[model samples]
Target: CKCPLGFEGINCTDNIDDCSNHTCQFGVCIDKINGYTCKCHSGFIGKFCEITSQLKSSLLQNNRTEILSKTCTPEICSNNGICYEDSLNRVQCRCSPGFIGDRCLMLKSVHANRNDSYMKLSKPKIFPHLNITMIFSTIQNNGILIYFGHMGHIVAELFMGRIRVSHDIGNSPGSVVFSYHTVNDGKIHELQLISIGQNFSLIVDRSYTRFINNRGIRTYMNTSEMDG
Candidate 1:
């Protein structure tokens, strides 16, 4: 009977213990069905002999799986989040709302909307790599609101009539940017509202503003204006 990959002995009964000698001298002695085969340790190869090869491929792969399995998964950040390994081998947490911390052991601030007048302008952007979602909401009066719970960084914009507001929360300009042009003439109040970040824009007449951008622009004109 042949033992598995790591074990070795007579009739595959003995384990080729590598630790006894502090390390395998030449190569690992893998016990087989009736005997054992010497898998030369790193840097050495050949049959019942000693030959060094610069291309030591087999030795490099040894114990790689076991070492990887021993790495501990990190548990950081708050709110029922998960731990993941970054490129630097550092563990980071993907936290939930109302929770935040280095090890996910602390509570974070909570902001909930109770007003029924407000509505979410657009759906959240999904990032599969970071396992996060970013959502943007808007109200008739409050402008745009960003929610980044598990997501890393988010960029959004909001527009109202001739005013445009945009922001990149994770980048330099953390606050909103405002741009607009005023139209004093009340006869044909043509205001163009452009929100580049949100991919939306709008044009408003005397009664209401028309929205445009990614969601498409619509003009909100009065009944009289529509009739004309």
Candidate 2:
């Protein structure tokens, strides 16, 4: 008995699958006569076709090795955003939907500006209470991490650095400031605020601050606008 064209056993019982264990990386491995062929995938080429064509093209354009320098690391852009360097060599981040900020770390907002930013939400069926939670990291000593507006009025605001909750109740403004560890050390910090009935509390890390609303005996009596 003789072995067939694509077989190599004593009775042509074995079929040669050259793609076994062959690392194609970015291509497919095709079996051939006496050997195998690498079918390079799109944007890749070489003998094994494992090299990225984009990198190869850059190398051929000029001898300057700087063309191959990658400014954006794999982890540089958060939330599946593309990281690329502009013509001025500044790193830029393109964030996806529901994400913002320089590194795509911020949740998308309705209105944004250097002075102030806000997110407007549809009025809920009930407005008896408000609760908020946020996680952020910044070195700025002041900023509004969260704000809630109801009936064309500023109802609540959570400030940065020192956790503060300012609110308006029946044409009177009240605030509760909590002394806690600041998040200006380039680390993420969690802040939570809950308002129910005639009471509210602010929590930063392990520190807690609570305020009670006294209808007859007012602890704080001031009418002012809260800053964000």
lDDT of 1 by residue, 1-228 (tens): 667765666676665554332222356556544345667665555552144442134235544343232234542233466777678886666665433544443433322323332334444332211112232222333333343322122332334422443323223333343434433222333333333342333333434443332221221111222211
Give the Cα-based TM-score of candidate 2 against the true structure: 0.39
Output the TM-score of candidate 1: 0.23
Candidate that would win on TM-score: 2
- Give each model's whole-structure lDDT: 0.38, 0.56
lDDT of 2 by residue, 1-228 (tens): 687666778777777776554545456778765567778878767767645465465556756444333588877666687888999897788876446656664444222322543455554322446556666666677766665544222232334656556644443545445545556665756666665544566666646565645233332222233323
Cα error, residue 223 of model 2, in Å, equals 19
Query: Which ranges in model 2 have alpha carbons more than 4 Å from their true place?
Result: 1-117, 124-126, 149-160, 206-209, 214-228
